[model samples]
Target: MSDFRADTVSGKLTTFMHRARAEGVAEPVRHEAKRLILNQLKASVGATGQQAVRLMLDWAMAEAQGGGGAHVHWFGTSLPPALAAMVNGALYEVLDFHDTYIPCFMHAVSGVLPAVFAEAEAGGHSGTAVVDALAIGLEVELAVATMLMPTGYYRGMVPAGLTGGVGAAAACALLRGLDASQTQHALGLAMCTPAGIYEAAGSHTLAWITGNAARTGLQAAALASRGFTAPPTAFEGDQGMFKTHSDEDRAKIDGILASLGTEWRIFGQTYKVVPTETITHGPVECALAILPRAGGRVVERIDIKVQEIVVTIVDGRRERFGRPSSTPQATFDLCHCVAAAWLRGQFTTAETSAPCYTDAEVIALSDRIKLTADPGRPTFEGCTMTVTFADGSSESHNVDYFLGTPNARVPDSTLIDLLEQYGAGVLPAGRAHAIADAVLTLDTAPDIHGLIRLLNKD
Candidate 1:
């Protein structure tokens, strides 16, 4: 309601987050916040044993042996909040199972939660406090992302990396109870390094970017609390990021600002039913359905019709876009994902990893796949797939809304089971279940120490 946009992007986002913390998140939205946390925990902790996690953890232990008091989620190593943020953030990304904001293809809650948990744990903040900060943090993150997406994406900017720090900064500042001015400064400082590109997907660098964004937010909030300041025009001036990263549409920026408190961008999010790329969910589900009907036919071709974003990301001109070169790239390759899932008869996290990715049959099927963009479909989640056989017969299946989408939401009971399953991958038995329980009661819980312990405990 206040004049959030009169100053710069920093001031506006700060006002939006600060105002929400003051009024407290609405009950329904707080429940949704809890849902995001549970999903993030499931997604992140499940990836603790990954190569990316090992790399970050080894670095944290070696360099941050005596950094500070913040404990890494799932690893229990004590380090500075910034370093802890890095490891936790990387965990969210390595699996590529986290939720994405459809509008920007940026991770909705992954980057921000690491910052929230780091600040909350280090400062001993309450879970009720976490829900509020997490909600506000995500609100600002999604807000900033909405202003830049599609256009920014068109310009080769990665949304999570570019907008992630701003979201993280907002959450940390709110948890630390920084005043509006300092919060604005934190936002500006957090935007200093927004490095992400489409090419980084398979290099193990994409996950690290998420980690760096979390670290950026934690450091920005910490420095701002002690009087560190960044340029007021960091985002919108002549040589600013708005022009550099996005299409610089003034109306899009202004519209998100106006919709801030009332509209709730966080509510618009859709969680992934499958662990692969978000846009690939509908197609994977469609492919899996079509596979059962194929019976004994030898598949000659696999035709996929997706939304425009899929085509933009996978033009099929490049070999890597059509055929994955590595495990991480395979997660994003539409053809590989569809082929692998159809052959395996399931599209779980296992299908995205080794042996399965390198399997001969999967690669053969992926080569047979072709993608077409459907102009009529407006959203990123739906797709139509047709599988042709050697007998000159074909079958097609269309998916409008797969499970875990906002249109067809995954039930909380199902999500609870999912969290337990993912958490059990690296955790002791019953640990993940306890983690899910803590999240369900998070709104009323006194502090997040118990949840942190559940994640960090041996």
Candidate 2:
């Protein structure tokens, strides 16, 4: 039994995987992983037409020209699974549409899945194995993230990409069936590659950084599988991952991981049902439910009160919540979300596309909106809004938590609905349902790649 420090991503991952496997993952855990994987697949495929996606695919294809070891096929290409995993993972993240865990505060799945799928396909692992690996990766990433999240958000570390590196490595290690020693080393190898900045949140590079983690993780695990080794204390020792990235309280991460066996961390993984924006903005969507209570009154003033992190992340943007001109911008900008929802009377995914681009009212309303920071609240909470009408009336809505937290989790049916709607535009309708059903029952499936194959375009 190794004792790991609080800030060490590698230490937390190693501990959680051992515990997750011991407790025996529940069916709901696998189902959630399936739902997230389906979402990532759709987002990856949809990204093919984006300029960033094309650019990344071009570079990846060039990288694919020569590689060794196993053939890990990507989703949309004839390339081997490993290479495809790199591309697919990158694509999933290239758009920043993948699921995120708030506790660990990282984009865990996007980076890890490509590697898991690649290895699962290469070695012909069962869907159960893939599901287990995903759960393990997410669990580990979230646990480590929880410790690092508090201080890092203010210090400029992009928690998702930072912790995602280790998660990706863990998933790949699971796929490769690596021993514990190798697993630890693979994580160490990944810790050395963590990259991404919070400043990049609004830009196209955000998704690519996430995907890059996948590629890096897969390569690290593959190298380790072939008897490569790195520093075992990659995360823990002096001059290591935490020392370089984190600024907050040191021991919080370790204390959380210590609860790994007794507490199932997967239960903490949050899901985003509304495609509106970032994790901080999820509560804003719920707050929008109160607009009708305002009696459709014209608002003289609108004030959004959120944790300081959200204010810092979204306030400076030219149109953070207005209609986003690009895909990347829409995820973080709350102004675009509020403007669209108010103008259209609904904020569907399509609204984030071109139609919202042409709406003048959304633009005008976005200009009127003002955002204020609440220093007293937690970043995960205080995503609230207040509207004051021209008449002598006002309404205040406070979302103490986001929609996808353990207390306010998105239902399984809602997750299924989201998958169907998100995938229906690209994949056949029946195929979308099948993807959901198959994912829900993945534990009994023959191989995980079978589900990956179903995600292919006809």
Put down candidate 2 lDDT per residue, 108-219, tens digits, no spaces.
7777787777777778888788888888887776666776675765577777678776777787787677777677778888877788876776676776677677777777
Model 2 Cα shift for residue 230 (angstroms): 1.0
In the predicted model 1, the residue pairs found to clash are none
* Model 2 lDDT, residue 193, Cα: 73
CA displacement after TM-score superposition, residue 251 of candidate 1 (Å): 2.3
Per-candidate TM equals 0.95, 0.87
- lDDT for each residue of candidate 1 in 1-458, tens digit (9 for 90 to 100): 32224368778777677777778789989988988888887777677667878987898888886787778877788888888888888888887888878877778687889888889988989889999888888888888788778788777767889988888988898888888778877888877667687668766888888988888888899998998887767788777777788885677778788889999878777877677778778888898888779897999999988887688777642455445656687777777888888888987777878888789999998888888889988887788899999999999998887777788887777777777777665777877778888998997888888888887758
Model 1 worst lDDT window (10 residues): 1-10
Alpha carbon deviation, residue 421, candidate 2 (Å): 1.3
